[model samples]
Target: MPDNMALIEERLKLYMINLWSRSYYMGTLGNMSKEVVERYIANQRTTKSNADHLSKENSALRH
Candidate 1:
């Protein structure tokens, strides 16, 4: 399996490529494609939610 830093760097490269490609195709720096942005936002929300839920559950179990 790939090491953690390598995995993160790979993901960053992919994200930059997506953003750069979208910027180029749209011909504007501010014009990120809605779908890509939405997906990114949704994933962020999901990760936060999951983390919060896990923390709550762990705390409850400890009590």
Candidate 2:
């Protein structure tokens, strides 16, 4: 019975540690995803601005 109890306690500790590590990893992933989204948005805006500029230039040349 004592051995079984010790095994149970060890299992519980391992489970708790695994849970904590997974949560920490998820938090880091969330932060990285946010940064990636911000960068993508900034890049999208820059691309749109460049496209608009090129369109205007093309129009001016045609005229």
Candidate 3:
């Protein structure tokens, strides 16, 4: 029973994280896409050169 409770708690934490991340990311997808596309446009923004790169953008939560 204790083990099951622990598993449930862990899963709940994961679920909440996933839910919050999805909501946060999806909400600004429209605006994000605009800013995001600029990166791909090449020499159009601050990060010159079009190249694939892993990025983690957490703009202090717009909403």
Please tell me which predicted candidate would have the highest TM-score against the true structure: 2
Q: Is candidate 2 or candidate 3 better by lDDT?
A: 2
- Can you give the lDDT of residue 3 in candidate 3? 100
Residues 1-63, model 2: lDDT tens digits: 999999999999999887774222334445566678678668978999999999999999999
Residue clash pairs of candidate 2: none
Name the weakest run of 10 consecutive residues (lDDT summed) in model 3. 49-58
Error of 3 at 1 (Å): 0.4
TM-score of each: 0.47, 0.49, 0.34
lDDT of 1 by residue, 1-63 (tens): 469989999999999887764222334436678897778668978999999999999999999
- Candidate achieving higher TM-score, 1 or 3: 1
Model 3: per-residue Cα lDDT at residue 25: 41
Q: List, residue by residue over 1-63, the lDDT tens digit for candidate 3.
A: 999999999999999887764223445446556656555444444353222221323333433
